[model samples]
Target chain A: MGTALKEKQEKDLQHEDLLHRYRNFSARRVLFIILGVLILFVLAAFSLTLGPADVTIAEAVNTLLGMPPSGTVDRIIWNIRVPRVLTAIVAGAGLAVTGAAMQSILRNPLGSPYTLGISQSAAFGAAFAVIILGAGTTQSTASDAVIFNNPYIISISAFIFSLITTGIILLFVRYKNASPATMLLTGVALGSLFTAGYTAMQYFASDVQLASIVFWTFGDVARASLWPEVVIMTLAVLLAFAYFFYKSWDYEVMDSGDESAKSLGVDVNRLRLHGMLLSSLVTALIISFVGIIGFVGLVVPHIVRRIIGGNERYLIPSSCIVGAILLLASDTVARTIISPIVLPVGILTSFLGAPLFIFLVIKGRDFW
Target chain B: MKLEIAGMDFAYDRKLVLKNVNLKVKEGEFLTIIGPNASGKTTLLKCINNILKPKKGTIKVDGNDINHIGMDGVARKIGYVPQMSNRAFPTTVFDTVLMGRRPHGNWKPSDSDYRLVSEYMEKLDLQDIALREIGELSGGQRQKVMIARALVQEPDILLLDEPTSSLDLKHQLEVMEMVDKQTENGLTVVMTMHDLNLALRFSEKIIMLRQGKIFAYGGAEVLDPVNIEKVFGVKVSMAHGSCGPVIVPESCVI
Candidate 1:
C-alpha cells in the first residue's frame, strides 16, 4: 500500500513538472515576421516614389506629414499614388491569406481565391451592371459612381455578384456533398458558367460600357481608391486574419486529414465550412475593387510556406506582407517601366511570378 | 478512464458498417481488435472516439455517455491515430505533434502542451527530426511522429487503426513496443492490428470481429484455433514462443 501510494505521488509530480516548465518560443520566427513588416513598409515607400510623377522619398514623407503641399506633387502623391498603393497592399494581402485558408479547407493545393469562380462572377456582375444601368441612365451616374468613368456601380455590382457566387458554393456545401473535390469541381463549373454569362452581357454593351468593362478586367489598383473608401476592406481583412489566427492551431490539426482532426475534438465540417465562407468573402471583397488580379492568391501562400513552415499563426501574416510587397513592387514596375504608359499590375505579376516560382521549384530539388 | 459501449449501430450513407456492438475496455488494458477488411474493426474504434456517430448506442468513458460530454471532451480522454494518412500535405514534425494540443487550447500552446510534446517526441526517438517536414520522413519515422502526436493529447484511452500495416517487420515490432509501453503507465489502448500474432503477443485482451459484430472476445484463451477458424475461415495452430503465443496459419480453408 505504501509503495503504491509513493508511485502514484511520483506520477503526479511528473505531471506537475510538465505544467511548470517555463515557455519561450523560437526567436528566429519572430525575427522573420518583424523583417516582413519592415520589408513591406520599405517596399511601399520605394513604390510610392516610382510612379509617373517622380515624387522623391523626402517629398512623399513631407506630403504624408501634413506639410503644405508642393502644388501638383502633393496632390499626385496624396490622391493618386497613396490610395493606389494602399489598395494594392490591402487587396493583395486579402487575396493571399484567403487563398491559403481556402487551400487548407479544400485540402487541395490547387485551391485559390479564383478556384470557386469568384473572379469570373465578380466580372460578370460588373459587366452586367454596365450593360443594364448605362443604357438606361445618363452619363451623370457614370462619373458619380466610377472612380474616373463608372466605378461605384461596377464595384457594387461585382460585390453583390461575388457574394451570390460564394452563396452558390455554400449551398452546395450544405446540401450536396461538401467534399473538397466537389467544391473544386463546383467552382470550376461556376467559373465557366459566369464567364459565359459575362460574355453574353458584353454582346449588348454599348461602346462606352464596353470600354469600361474592358478596363475593369485589366485589374489595376489605380481604379480602386479615392480617399478613405479602401479602409473598409483593410479593416475587414484584418478582422478575418485575427479570427483565423485565433483558431490557427485547429487549422494545423486539420492538415492531418478530417477524421484524424475530428478525433482530436475538432469540428472538421464546421471549420471547413467556416473557412470556405471566410475565404470567399475575402476574395469577393478584393475582386469587387481590384478586378480579378490573378496568381497572388495562389502564389503568395506557397512562397510564405516555403520561407516559414506551414503554421497559420505565422503563415497568415507572412503571406499578407509578402503578397503586399510583391504586388506593390509589381505595381511600381507596371507604372514606372514605360514612364507614362502604365501597364496593368495584373500582367506584371504573372510575368514576374511564374519564372521565380519555377526557379524555386527546381532549386528545391530534394524538398518534394 | 474506462471505455464502455452498449447497443451501438453505425452506418455510412445508411449502409450499416457496425451493428449491435457492445464492448467494455478497462483502464490500462491493452485490447487488440482484429478483423478482416470491412469487418467493422475501424468503425468500432471510430465510434468509441466520436469520429463516427452511432445510429443508436451509448458510448461511455468512466460511465459517462460520450455523446453527452461532446467531442472536445471525448478528445481530452481519448486519442485516435488513423491507419493511413498519405493524403496529408507536408508540415514540420513539431508542428504536427503540437496540433494534438488543440483540444486543450485555441490560440497558442500552453507550456504543458510543449513539455508533453517534447517528452513524447523524445520517447519516440523523434527529437532528431522534429524540425523536418513529415513528408520528408520515411514511413517508419512518420508513423512514430503520428504516435507522438496522439500521445500529446494526454488521453486516458488511445485507439489506433492498422498503425503498422505498411511498416517492415522490424519497424512493426518497434512501433508495437512503443504503444505497449503506454499501457505500462496508466493509459488504456485499443488498437486494430493486421498481424494476429502481434495482437496475441501484445494484447491483454483480444476481440475478434466479423460482419460488424463481436464474434468472440476475451484473453488469449478466446483466441484459440476453433474461434480463429470461425472468425477468419483459416486453419491456424498456436504454439508457445519465447515471448508469447505464436499463430501459424496452415491453410486458407475457406
Candidate 2:
C-alpha cells in the first residue's frame, strides 16, 4: 500500500512536470506573438510619420483615424504615406508566409518565391503585358489608358506565369524523381530564362515604358495606390494566411516525406500540391502589386524557424509579423538614407536581407 | 484483421520487382519476410501497404477490397514504419506520434487523440522523450518513437521495413521483444528482417524470398543448417538453445 501510494505520487509529479513544460512553451510562443504584433503596430506608426513631407505624429494619427484634419496633413498622410506603409506590411507578410509554406512543402531551406523562380516568371509576365500588350496604340490610347499605364496588370500577369512555372516544376520533380538540388537548378534556369526575356523586352521598350518596368521590378511602395489591386492582394494574402494556419499541422507532417506522411493518413501529394499552389497564389498576388521584393520571404521564415521550432503553426504567423516589421524598417531606411531620392524597397531589402542571411548561415552552421 | 494479397505483381517501368506474389497474413500472426538485398522484400512490403500500386493484384483487408476503399481507409487499418527516420524539420516525439491520429483527427488533435498518443508512448517506453525533438534522439529511440506513431493509428496490421537495420544489438532485441508482445495482444505484424537469427527468434513464421520468388515459407524448425547454407550461400550450424535454436556461422567456431 505504501509502495502504491509512492508510485501514485511519482506519477502525479511527472504529470505536473509535463504540464509545466507545456505551459512554459505556450507562454514563450504567446509572448513572442504579442511582442511581434506590438512591434508591427509601432512600425506602422513610424512609417506614417517618416516621409519627405513630415506630418506631425498627432496629425498622422488623426488622419489615420479619419478625423477632420488640416488639408495638407490629411493629404500627405492619407494620400501618400498610409497606402505605401500598408502596401509594405501586406506585401511583406504575404511574401514571407508564402516563402515559409514553400520551404516547408519543398523540404528545402533555400525555397522561396524568388528562389523558385516565381518572381522571375512574374517579371516575365509583367514585361509581356507592358511591352507586348501595352505597346498596341489602340489599347494604349483608349479610355482604359490608365489601366494599361498601371503596373498592376503586369504584376498580375507575372503572378499567373509564376504559378504556372511553379506547377510545371512540381510536376517535373514528381515525375523525374529529381533531387532537391535538381529542382533548385531547374528553378534557377527558369528564372534566368524569364529574366533574359524580360531584358530583351526592356531593350525594345520606349524610354518611359522602360523606366516604368524598371521601377516596378526594383519595387517602390511610394508607387502603390489605394486601389482595387491593393484591396485584392490584401484579401488574397489574408485568406491564404488563414487557410495555411488551419492546415499548419498537415504541412508539418508533410515535411517528413511522402511515405511517412501517407502512412500517417495525410494525402501527401495533395497536401504538397495545395501548399505550393496557395503559396504561389499569395506570391503572385503580392508580386503583382509591389513587384518582386526579395529576402523577406527567404530570410523571415528561417529567422522564425530558429526562434520557434519548425512547427508551421508558430512559424507561419511569426514569419508574417517579422516580414511586416522588417520591410517597414527597410522602407524607412530607404526613405531616410538617400533623403530626397528614395531607394527601391526591393534594393533595400536585398541589401539588408543578404547580410542578415549570411550572418544567420555563419551562426547556424551546425543547425539542420 | 486478416490481410490478403492475391497474385500481386509490381514493376518499376518495365523491370518487375514482384511477380505473382500471393500472401495471406492471418489475424494476430507475426510474419517476417527474410531475403537478400534486391530480393523484393521492400517491394513486397510496399505492395502490401498499397504504397506501390501492384501491376496486377488485389489486396483485401478483413473482407473489404482495398481498391474499393480509399487510400485513407487503407491507411487507417494499416500502419507502415519505414527503415530510416528522415525528418526534414525538427518534430517532437509527441507531435510525431500525434500525426498517427491524422486519419481520425480533424484539423486539431482531440482529447482522445492525445490520450491515445500518451498511452502508446508509455507502452513504448518513449514517455520520457515525448516532448523531445525527434532529431535529438538516438537511432533506437527514434525507431521506438516511429513505432509509437504507428501504434497511435490503432492499426490492426503493422508493416515494418528493415525496422532493426540501424539499431544496436540491445535495441534490436528490445524492439523485436516489443513486437513479440504486440502479437500476443492480437496486433498483426508483418516485417522484413535481414538478420536470420533475429527472424528465427522473434517471428512466428518466416517467409524467405530469393530473386522475387519465395524460396521457403514455414516454421523456424524447417530453417535448418542445410537450408540456411543453400539459401544464403553461407555455411551455418543450428544448435538447440534454452528457448530455441541458435544459428552460428562456421567462421565463429575456433
Candidate 3:
C-alpha cells in the first residue's frame, strides 16, 4: 500500500513539471511580426504616393492593378515608383537577413557585408570597369555627366570581384580551419586592401571617369530595370530567407559557443562556410546593382533582437520585414525631404542609423 | 555505457598534451579526474567525446569505437558540458536548454522535447528564469543551466569539465548531489575536479593525472595525502566530515 502511494506521488510530480508551452515562442513575438508587416505595407504605399509628381494611393493601386488614371500617372507609378519601392523592399530584406546570418556565423556583432569588405571590393570592381574597361562615357549634355555604355559589364565585374574576396576567406576556413576572429580579421585586412585599390583608380582617372566612379558608388535603387533585376532580387532574397529560417535551430544551438555547438551535433565548420558563402553572394548581388547601401544591414537585426529577444526563428523573419520597413522609409524621406533635389538613400540611412544605433547601445537593455 | 580508452596520444604542434593514456570506466560509475594545471584532464575528456582527435589510439563506447560512430550517433550516446563562459548572443534559458534536443529532432522541438526540457529545468530550479537571457544569469545559475542542457540530451555517458568551478559551497553541494542522483539511476558520469574533498565525497572512482599521464587510478582510496603531494606538489591531510573523507591541504611540498 505504501509503494502504491509513492508511485502516485511520483506521477504527480512529473505532471507538475510539464509546462503548458515553451516560453521562447510567445504571443508578443508573433504580434511584433504582424505589426512589422503592416508597417511595411503602409510605408510602401505611402512611399509610392510621395515623389516629385504626386499620385494618391488609389491611383497608385489603380496603376499597379493594370488600370491607370492617365498615361503619365501610369509612367510615374509603373516606371518610377514601382521599381523603386520593390527594389528597396528586396534589397533591404536581403541585406538585413545577410547581416544577421553573418553575425551569427562569424560570432561577431560587427559582422556585416559592409564591415566584411564585400562592398569595398564591389566598389573597386565598378571603378575598374569605369576607368579601365571604358564602360562609362561622358554625355554630350554636361561636362560632369557620364552615362553607362553597358551597365551589365559594370555589374558583372563588381559581382566577380566580390566573389574573389569570398573565395579567399573560404580557402582560409577550409585549409587552415581559421577561427571566427581570424576570419573577421582577414576581412578587415582585405577591406583596407580594396579601399587602397579604389583610391589608386581614382587618382589616374579622367574628370569624367572620376565623376562616373563617384556616381556609381552612390547607392540608388532606381538604377534597376523593372523586368529582370527586381524579379531576380526577389527570388534570391526569398531563397536566402527561407534557408536561414529553416536553419534557425542550428543557429540557436550555435549561440552557446562553437565547442558547445559541436558537442550538440552541429557541424560548426560546414555551417560557417555555407553561411558565409550565401551571405556574401546576396550582398554582392545587391551592391553590384544598387551600389552600396550602408547601415541597414548592420542595424535592423539589432533593433528586432532588442524588441523580441534573440531566438532566430522569430529574429530572421522579423528582421526581413523590419529591414524592408527601414530602407523603404529611408528612401521615402530621402526623396521627399529635400524637394526635387533628391539625396542618395545611403546618405540618409547613415545620418539616421548612426544616431539610432548609438542610442540603442547607450540607453537600451544589454542584449549581448 | 562503458568507456574504454586505449593507447591514446595527443599533441599540439610537437608538444604532447596527452601521452599513452589508457583507462576504463564501467557503466553507471561516477569517475572524477583530479589533476593540477596543464595535466591534460580536459584533453582526455574531450577525446572521449570526439571533440579532439587523438594522435594515436581508439576510444570506444559500449565496445563500439566512437571514432567509427558518426557525430550524430556519438552525440546520442555521450553528452558533453563544456566549462562555463559568457555567451555573446542573448538566448533565453528555455531555448538554451531545449537545444539539447537537436540530435533527436530537427529545428522545431516536438511536444516531448518541450516536456523534457521543462522537467529538467524544474529539477535544476531554473523554471523561474526560463525567459531570462543566459548572459544575465549568475555563474552558478549558468552552470545549472548547462547541466540541465546536458541532462535533456538523455545520453548514457555524461562528460563535464570543471562542473563546479566558481560556485559557492551550497551551490557546489547542490550540483554534485544532482549529478550523484543521476548516476544512481544508471547514468555514467565523468568529470574533472579541482576540489579534492568533493571528489572524494561523491566520486565512486577517481583518476589522478600528472604530466599528461595517469598517476593513479582506483577507487576513492586513491585520493591519499601522499598521492596528492606527488601529483600536485602539495602536502595534505585527510579529515572526516559529515559527508565523508575530506582532503585538507597542509603546505606546499618543498
Candidate ordering by lDDT (highest first): 3, 1, 2
lDDT of each: 0.82, 0.79, 0.87
Note the B-chain TM-score for every model. Answer: 0.96, 0.95, 0.97
Each prediction's DockQ against the real complex: 0.49, 0.54, 0.64
Better of 1 and 2 by lDDT: 1
Candidate 3 C-alpha lDDT tens digits along A160-270: 989888889989999999988988988889989999999999999998889888888888776664758999899989989999999999888887788888788888888
Q: Which segments of model 3 are wrong by more than 4 Å?
A: A1-25, A66-75, A140-146
Model 1: per-residue Cα lDDT over B45-162, one tens digit each = 8888888889998899999988888778999899888988754456778788888888888678887777778777767877668777888888889888888888998999999999
Report the lDDT tens digits of candidate 1 across residue range A1-368: 99999987875665445333312234455677899889888888787788656678878888888873578887888788889899989888888888888888888778886788888999998887778765223342432233334667778889898888789889888888569888888898998899999998778777667766776777888777766567887887897788777777788778778888898888988898888888898788888878878999898877766666677777878888878877888888888887577788899988887777777666642344
Off by over 4 Å in 1: A1-26, A68-74, A135-148, A204-208, A365-367
Taking all chains together, each candidate's TM-score versus the true structure is 0.92, 0.90, 0.94
| Fnat of every candidate, listed in order | 0.63, 0.50, 0.62
Interface root-mean-square deviation of model 3 in angstroms is 1.6
Best by DockQ: 3
| lDDT tens digits by residue: candidate 3, B188-230 | 9999999998899899999999999999999999999889989
Per-residue lDDT tens digits for candidate 2, residues A1-368, read 99999987886566556545655776787788789999999888877888667677777788888883688888887677877788888888988898888887778888987777888888888878877777311223221122235455676677688877787778876687655556677888888988899899889998767755665677666555575656777898898899889988788878777788877667776776677778887887778667778888988988776666677778878989988888888888988897766677888987887777678767742347
